[model samples]
Target: MFLAVGLGNPGTRFERTRHNAGFRVVDILAERLGVPWKSEDRFSWARGVVGDKTLYLLKPLTFMNLSGEGLLAFFAHHGCAFEELIVIHDELDFPPGVVRIKIGGGVAGHRGLQSIVEALGREDFVRVRVGIGKPERRELVVDHVLGVPEKEESIILEAAEKRAAEAVLCIVEWGVQRAMNVFNAREENGQKEAC
Candidate 1:
């Protein structure tokens, strides 16, 4: 079994914010798979299959800071290993709409990532990063992430969310190495890389 976790704050207030990029990606995946989410005490989940593999899509309701709590509960019940876990979240380093795949790394101060690392006691899980770009002033970081993007940026981000969902599917179908090759290379070439 493979588990994919999308990090974001729950509720309509945060629905379109840049910080909710992960949730957007997972939402797309769920729609594509025609799976309906079932809400748990701490999170919501949808189950589907891809090429004979069962994949669980999770969205924590504990919000961004306490995301790990919901994840820990999921682990306790469903029992998944660190290696089989994939986390999707926003990235401030890359330009808006850029998507990247990574295997284990620091949280880069992302509260959601930090929470997961703390709960899991490891940082080696797979990550699908959806870039939201950074704020001009360091002090504006919070406002930037939690704020909704401009019309043009929203269009870009919407596309990125779809691509991030595709990247997750690719990783499940062909493994992380192949997914990284396809996605990361695409990033460099400024063109879609065939999987």
Candidate 2:
């Protein structure tokens, strides 16, 4: 079974934050797949499935800094191979409307991803980098990412997520490269194709 994990802090407070993009995608996955995502405190996870794939939908209660603990335990408990794992998280490097799906790249100062790499004991797993873009000013970086997108911007963000969900399907069914090619396409002036 393929293991799909979305990275985000768990709680009502984080529900609408841009930094919680991963969690939002997880919700999308749950709805699209009709997965009964039960709250599993034992695994520190929300467990479910999509298609024939067994999905371990997770929101780390350990907060963003220590996400590895939950991820490692989940893998160990399920006996899931490293190849079966895929993580979806946000990236500050790309514009808000884009998503980058690649295999084994640097974490680029993302502590959450850094923690995952450290705990996974490998650097080759696939990552779906959903871009929220860079902040206008360095001082506002945290607030910008963690804060909710304004109503107008929310349209673009939701479009990004819908595309992301499809990309996740392609990644799981085909492979990362195929998904990358299919999902990474843009219009002449640079906008994602319709979902």
Candidate 3:
């Protein structure tokens, strides 16, 4: 069983925020996956089955900063190592719609990832980061992450989530290395367009 976690906070109020991009990716993964996910035993997440594999596509309900609260325990319970886990989250530093995948990298000041590292006591897992666009105002990082994306920005979201959904399928169907090659290192950086 591979654990694919899309990290984000709970609540309808945060539905369209850049911070919730992870949640959007999870929904996409569910929709396009070859196999279906049925209600199964899970914690702070949802379980879906696909192609002889059982996957846990989770959206952390513990808010951004405390994402690992449930995942760490869940990992241990199932004897799944940190390597078997794949995390998806939003990145404000990169342009919107860009997806970056890497293994064992620092959080780059993301509190949620920091929390997850602390909970798991390691940073050797796969991370699928959806770039949600750079901050217009540097000091407003918190607000920007939590703020809702604008109507014009919806296109960026669409592109990034679509890529992320494909990345998830790749990760499960192929492997981390293959997914990284296809998802990351894209020829275009979310198809950068003039503002």
Clashing pairs in model 3? 37-48, 37-49
Which pairs in model 2 have colliding backbones? none
Best by TM-score: 1
The per-candidate count of clashes, in order, stands at 0, 0, 2
Whole-model lDDT for model 3 versus the true structure?
A: 0.76
Q: Is candidate 1 or candidate 2 better by lDDT?
A: 1
Query: Per-residue lDDT of 132-154 in model 3, one digit per residue for the tens?
Result: 87777789888888988888788
User: In model 2, what is the error at residue 22, expressed in angstroms?
Assistant: 0.7
Q: Give the clash total for candidate 1.
A: 0
Clashes of 3: 2
Expressed as tens digits, the lDDT of each residue in 1-195 for candidate 2 is: 666677787788888788778777877877887766655442345455555556556655566767787776676666665356778888898888677788897888887888888987777878877888888898998898788888977888788877777777777677777777767764223645433
**TM-score, predicted candidate 1 vs. hidden true structure:** 0.97
Question: Which ranges in model 3 have alpha carbons more than 4 Å from their true place?
Answer: 33-43, 76-83, 187-195
Q: Write the residue-wise lDDT of candidate 1 on 1-195 in tens digits.
A: 788999999999999999999998989999999999999899999999888888899999999999999998887777765347899999999999899999999999999999999998999999999999999999999999999999999999999999999999999889999999999889878876667
**Stronger candidate by TM-score (1 vs 2):** 1
Q: Write out the backbone clash pairs for model 1.
A: none
- Taking all chains together, each candidate's TM-score versus the true structure is 0.97, 0.87, 0.84
